[model samples]
Target: MAYDEGLAHRLGEALGALPGITAKKMFGGIAFLWNGNMLVGVIGDDLIARVGPEAQADALAQPGARVFDFTGRPMKGWVVVDGAAVSEDSALDDWIGRCREFVEAMPPK
Candidate 1:
C-alpha cells in the first residue's frame, strides 16, 4: 500500500532532525522509530502518535484529533491527528513530541 509522498517526505524530514529517530514504511503507512521503538507515524492521511495512556487524554483534547485505533478497538496511549491539521509546523511538532516522550521512556529495542 502506498501513502502520500508529500506528507511522508515532510514527516521524514521532521523525524530526521530528531536525534535517535528513524523511520520505515509499515502496514501501508510510515512508522517513525526512536531508539528502535515505534514513536509516531503516518497512516494514509492520518497522523498516528504513541503518546501513552497517561498523555492520550490531553493529546486527544487537541482539535482534529482522535484515538489511533489500528484494530477495531481504540489503542490506549495512542492518538491519530487529522491530516489537515498537520499542515502547520507547530501542529506536527505536537504529535512528534508525544512520540518522542514515549520513546524517551522506553528501553531501546
Candidate 2:
C-alpha cells in the first residue's frame, strides 16, 4: 500500500516545530529525528513510535497500537499505531512524546 504523504506532511510539520527535531525519508517512509536520533516514523498509514521496552506495556495499552516490526521479528522498544489513533494532534503528540523520551536517552549518532 502507498503511504499517505498528506499525513506525513502534517506529522512532519508538528515534529519539526519541536526543538532539535527533523524529518527525513527512508524505507519508503518518513522518519522523525529527535536530537539526531531516530525517534519515530510514518509508514503507510501507521504512526511508528519508539517507546523503550520499559514503556512498551504502556504503549501497547493504547488503542489501535501494536509492535513495530519491519523485519521478521518484532522490534523491542517500538510500536506502530493505526492512522485513526493519530488523526488528532493530541494523540499524535502523545505518541511523539513517548518516542522523544526514548530517543533522548540514546547517544547521539
Q: Best candidate, TM-score-wise?
A: 1
- Candidate 1's displacement at residue 60, Å, is 0.9
Q: RMSD in angstroms, all models?
A: 1.3, 1.5
Off by over 4 Å in 1: none
- Expressed as tens digits, the lDDT of each residue in 15-108 for candidate 1 is 7877777788886898878888988888888788888888888989988899777788899988888889888888888778777776698888
Worst 10 residues of 1 by lDDT: 1-10
Using alpha carbons, what is the TM-score of model 1? 0.90
lDDT value for model 1: 0.82
Q: CA lDDT, every prediction?
A: 0.82, 0.84
